[model samples]
Target: MGSLFLTACGNLNSSSTSSTTTTTQSSSSGYQTTGQSSDSEYQSVIQNGSYLTSKARGVGITQNSENMLNLKAFESGLTTLSKTEFSPKDYIFREGQLLSKSTVQKWLSRKSSSNPTGLNPKDNGETDADKRNPIYVQQIEEQDYMKEENGKLVLAGITIGIGMNRKDYYQKEEYGATYTTTISKAKMIAEGKKAAAEVLKRVRKLKGASDIPIMICMFEQAPNDSLVGGTFYAYNVSKSSTLGTWKSTNLQSSVLPTTSESTAINDNDESSFTSFKNKIQNFFPNLAGVTATTKYKNKSLQELHVKITTQFYSETEIRSFTQYVAQAAKTYLPSGIPIDITIKGSDGDIQAFIARESDSSSYYTHVFDD
Candidate 1:
């Protein structure tokens, strides 16, 4: 009797589809061409086309999609500046500064919610919903102050603002609404310092990895216009360091920034399957097609499973070698398969199993555990 085995073959490239627009770029330096559009509305220093069309004039623009959008903007902006006979370095500085301030204004406006009175009946009675009191809040919206630190160009500092409670309003039936103004300058300053410290730590690490610049943007707002508040931070990993190792704890939070990495896989599953079948055909020239079978059984606690055994041959020594047989079988095995060979008498047996549980659009192959 020969060893029994099960195997499965799948097509890998069946899921791949063609795209209409494609841009080729050198993958080594990270300056890959990411396509361009001729539409004037989408035309800008950014090659993506969407950013130029979406961005409003005179408004501060922060890099949105990590290095992809930012690198595109930086490179394109440099090209635009050079063509116009302007200094690229000066433009970066000037634009960055202006954008920082605009971002601060945007942060402040966001703190002003539609319902500031806290008159809504369903308001949960908590510190956050204390409309009677206003808390002093300060924050930096954006900063891009670049300076040389330890032989590396680093961006330090940040854009921030503070809001202090101007008054406390209370209900007085006869006199209508009246309140007293009370502001906490100490609290405002403390929060600002804390934000600065955190931002500084991030800046230091970013500067250390100058090869992979991290662009940082922060936004803060009053929680329900009450004395409570929160902050938001966004950062992008530069294209220059895309292949390097980077860690970002900020991305774990729901409100913070995130990043992505992409890769391509070989897509020629049909040909691969055909090659596999041809190899198997040569191994057992007279053997019929293989079939898959599955068996399942349940046992009770009292019953013990018994083993059955059978023997066919005593012992004999005989051998024959064929390079073609070995080559054909090896070529058909998947890249990750582990092969173990054994011989008895004059016959050879290959024992292995291939289990596939992938969908039509994807290919997944798993070898059975011995």
Candidate 2:
């Protein structure tokens, strides 16, 4: 929450900014100006800035401060925390570890969208309130896992920060590029993993770090579009050029707190998601969009969640709409796969309804989101 910017996009040995003030530009949508978070009223503390001043907070010092490590080309993206130790010895304290601001927002401007609100506001979900203020203070500690290196323990992993803002519709740039919202999901995933592979690009400049494994937390959010538009993502980034492991949490169950799933799916798989989305878009008219994923247990598919966003006029209309979606989706998916449908009106609360293979046993529920 403190520092949201990616490691200053280059060699870790790059020139350093002595001041606490760090400038970073977020991807702006339908804005009066470009996607510059550091410009306008938006400002953020660099993640490394907090790391550089960790000594002031009594956080552990990195093995080497002056030496910048270089990263080799590798596969990257987000994943759950797997090979990390939470002990204090594994943390790397750096300068500016005491940056004041925990989150940075550009609320002075509005991005036009088809949403009923007509304006898209980006929120960093670090706090529970909607307060819109910034301060220059933060106390942060960076931690990594340790591995044996030539008979010695060394810090060997890093968490690469990536965020996906939820909106009426998600827009992203092309691979290897920033600020272009005209790209496909496949391209976005590929590009994201590519970026993740370079987590060491800047931190390696720190003498003590080397061949660090990367973890990604892709926080994708949208404005009440569906259960997915208001949730968090957890992924396990791999260092061996393999796909990252992943998962997510949805808060929309607040609207229907009695819901639960039988099996969990990999929320990060793109191909499965795109296929289900295409099916809904083709079957339903006025489809705002969809977010679908499959969950696996012990390497076998067990559960499916299909979250849909569309237009509806009233309670009866929404119920009928959900009936058709849940039914069709239940029929469309293969046999025995427990499917749960999370339906959201263009700007309404998310209602969860479980659909089974029987076709006669579907009911909407107040699914509890944990």
Candidate 3:
């Protein structure tokens, strides 16, 4: 991974002396800093300059049947929640390293006579549709936090994300039409909590994970037809095998230029996005389309990501258009919030990237050379 930072914009800092330098701060856990990878990788956690990724990366993609939006949001949202307890300054971030792909696959399966370790409801031969067991747990994700002790990195904490299905689709016979089982929010939460408890019990048995604090988050996945992904609704951290009181999160995702009346969209934010879209498109008439996927917390915008498609092919045109986009973003979009914009050609290759960090007025721009 060539400098793991998000490629929305290539590294814009030209005066950097060393590429290996990482953020240094006093650790509350009293562990001295060692080394970390470059901070650009969006998926990997970086703290105290140490960058270790999951032994099993992208496993969630194959395991979970949800759309890519849901998969990405599920993991990233869990990391945001994990930070309240596992501070980046204190703990080194690692992806899902503890739970192997096979382990998670087993946990996602339905409980049966042979598969005794399955976490889902037991398979029963019932003819009635009402009596059938719905597959509550769809996918599971694990993230590990480590700290240096005795000149060695040890497991400090763990966070597990349990993705629950809102609609379970199945086929009764071979090459048959699929049937949908809709799970109510109340029923989903109850099953999610039960799965959390059982997951905690098994995770505690792993080596070196006996006493470390573990955070478990429950995610409600969107329906199949939804363009936006799901959100983590509740989470709880446990010091041992026993879980504690659950806390709820208000994190949610919405597509820009609202399409649904059920989803409450902020008028100001929507209008700002509309303005930004109009400005960029007006600058270049050859543009194909502009869209955004936004994430909010407690009804406040937290992150805005835009994707622009264009028919222009010239590198000079791409760079010039990116500059206009950056200016339009600053003038019309919401200030003091993280914003990322990517310009792509009709072929789907990224042409340029522009990003604005939270609370920063400047925008970083990069146009990829062919």
Candidate 4:
């Protein structure tokens, strides 16, 4: 493919809708890959307006099943950074097709007598938890970007996410008592970069992907019990086999209402969330709860994801409540940043969705019926 730079500006005003048909392919490693048809077409999740995702999803779980928050943040957080380099307007989004489940499984394994390609430190005989070499790499994720050439979509760029463990949890035997080993931030970054460098080299060798501009990010995974996900601390883009100087991402994730003593959040944003939460709950006292997860880049709010749980079952009541929520979101929430609010009933079914794009004055709303 030629240079990804384009003279035509991409439309980022609001979400656009597209339709897709599903098809499944089995990787050589035996993992079933479900995605759109062979047309290389894109499909949006209906709620997310930013980019169209590949009809075929990537074939693997990149995060621990217990820590789902990190999985969501890991993929979406990388997307936010990827957008800075690869604009969704110019590139169609697809899950990491280059890395398969079996390939990732080998890479994530600890280097030992059997698994030499493993990215983690080799196992040395040691009973002391403090002296043992911990598992630095937890999982790896890939995102591919394609650009049109000769009226066909071709691979133009790739983004790789390296998820490292802040705390390594393990069990010597099946169903045995679990043990934990803490990894320092310094050690984590060093190992993560080393693994990323190796990953770049391997990806460069993948079929016909050589010389493609690749961006690799280093993420610190949160503990299994953390309420909020971890953050990406550094990233670098490589156009060749050798990686370049790393740059700090300054990306962070936090829960709304500012509950952390160490996390420094925008006072205005916190106050706005508090007011919005209070206003709706005060009006509808039977609400189960109201909460949110926020993303910040360079300490500025970039995205807000809100979830409101209620007990109301009537469509009439849900529609009325959605209207009130939308009004409150516009009047009180921070402006010029994308905000997504989802209201659900006690049964956990989505009742309505409200969203606002960045720099847009007005918001959009939708109420679903049974």
Candidate 5:
């Protein structure tokens, strides 16, 4: 990730040669009159810095070196074999006459050596993968189709280059003001709608299922603000049957002051996490019954190293806990077989442990198995 630093520029003053002059007169009331200046020097300096930062974040050269190399190889490979007399005029490599198969192979080999990971070695092999040779084969096909059907290559090399560069620019400034103020605001309105449509499509897959509703949250920072703390938007996702669409609901808003202390910052994070968890639980009652435990004790003394054993139970009572424990363990057990939930016969003997997962899908999978 690239870092954004606040830049300062020297303040510029008006030249004495300018016809504009300022005369100040102070009265007993301490009132003074001043001439109107072309611009405030300090204000101008700040504005200039802001403009430069925005532009730099907008068009900064931050190419994905790997992707560019791959693109170059694709273009070069097309240029090499495109020289044959029998080759199609609309083909990607029409700059020269076609070369022999061996010559083409040598060219490809050289290019591949330069970027071993860019082009799959198997692409040139005599297998199903070989059929997909020619690095930019898709581009070539698209170009040919465009010329044959539309009468021209609607998208040129320059256009492709610009698109690639724009992607690089976005990646570099993903957390910068250029993205939030200039790009994301517009993109969120447009792409967020598109994303909502796609979400609706997926929700349709679960039409009548009694599963819990899905929620989405978004956070955006203010312009001229660094992403230090508490600057984001949150939303909840829900399907609207009456409107036949999906919608997001705002949850909360918070802002961290520039002089906020470290303890305050930590408290804010914990509060946000807890609030989010509570909101989910409120919306999904089933989740409330699902208690998560983080420590467990092993019944067998031989496994003293694993002294702690954990288990999960649906019922609130300690006795009924084992039944829920068995259910949780069943998910990971082999098919056509069952495992004993009771580590020991004593009441509340079953201990439950919880583990965090990287994604929402398996958020609770590790607790029972591991």
Candidate 6:
């Protein structure tokens, strides 16, 4: 069986569970391994994490479809970045929960009633209504990868994360390495079984995927914060497990600062702006346009924010062009002021990254892809 390895930042250690696992067990390695149902693991071949569009965003749990949006982008010098797609469809979507964080936390603590079988395979009506839906959306981090077919986005592979309490899995001390927390093997099994059921339920709806392989994975998510990481146990038709990994959440939970101090404006960066524009054009000949704005004053440089809009035909172009322009902006524009870069694509697709001049580690990501 061919397996797809997703490059995530953390480590995952575990075994496999059949599509019908009902019980969970713990290995000597301190990882939770779920029981497998008597089913085949060669059911699907999950592809690498890729891009999608709005219409096909949650196909994993909704329509069992793959992603189809592919973009071609590059710098002026034709330099390309790593092969990754950064668009609206690349991330996961959680149902809007207006309830306070405290209330959501309480809901997650309740035991998961894992009656995996139901009429609506995507979501077991009883469990989804009683245990899963009210607590949180069950699909993992985001739809990982997919491609275009017949002018629509289909899901090639995805990571369906079962919501779990972080405090139950690992303990992070104030001044030491994180330690694995002891969680009941039964609960862990229930989580994986539910995820596998969701995959099987959705897969049944596909048109011609009976023989085509799809990779089904399970992950653990934090209750209300952005902390998401865990090993994905891969289950094949033979009921065997292959270890997989997920990206560690680099996002901080505390609210990002929105307000900036308004100080004197320096309208004197004209020459600097010219240099900036020249450098950007030299690298990205296909650059659509660049917009520079100043707000919230610092001592030397006005809070400098730049938005670079481009029209790229592929993901490679967008990735490299965005990075090239961002690096160029800092060199030409006045330093010591916080900088924000927003990249707008031809189809009005947008993504943004920010960095505080004083601290490099304080980088923040604000997704405006909507």
lDDT of each: 0.27, 0.36, 0.77, 0.76, 0.24, 0.36
Worst ten-residue run, lDDT, model 2? 68-77
For candidate 6, what is the TM-score? 0.26
Q: Score candidate 2 by lDDT.
A: 0.36
lDDT at 291, model 5: 18
lDDT of 6 by residue, 283-370 (tens): 6566456656543222244355566676767666666666666667657766665677777777767855545564452444444433
Error (Å) of candidate 4 at residue 205 is 2.4
Give lDDT for model 1.
0.27
Q: How well does each candidate superpose onto the true structure, as a TM-score?
A: 0.22, 0.28, 0.83, 0.80, 0.19, 0.26
- Pairs with backbone N, CA or C atoms under 3 Å apart (clashes), candidate 4: 35-55, 35-56, 36-55, 36-56
Report the lDDT tens digits of candidate 5 across residue range 1-370. 0111222233333432111122232311111111123221111112212332221121212222223332333332222222221123332111111122232233223136554422112334422222323222011110110111122111111001001110111222345432211333544334434433343343334323113232332322222232221111223334342113332322222222213522322343334334433432333223432211111112111100001123324333333433343343333322221112223212344344322222222212122332
Error of 3 at 50 (Å): 14
Q: lDDT: which is higher, 4 or 5?
A: 4
Candidate 3 positional error at 355, Å: 0.5
- Report the C-alpha displacement of residue 337, candidate 2, in angstroms: 7.0
lDDT of 3 by residue, 54-169 (tens): 66666778755647777877887887888888876566666766687777877889888887889888877652456778888988999887665443456788899999988887
Per-residue CA lDDT of candidate 4, range 285-353, in tens? 675478888888898999999999998857888999999999999989999998999999998989999
Clashes of 1: 12
- Backbone clashes for every candidate come to 12, 45, 7, 4, 18, 39
lDDT of 2 by residue, 228-327 (tens): 2212234555554443565442211111111253122333333444544566665445655665544443444455566677776567656666656655
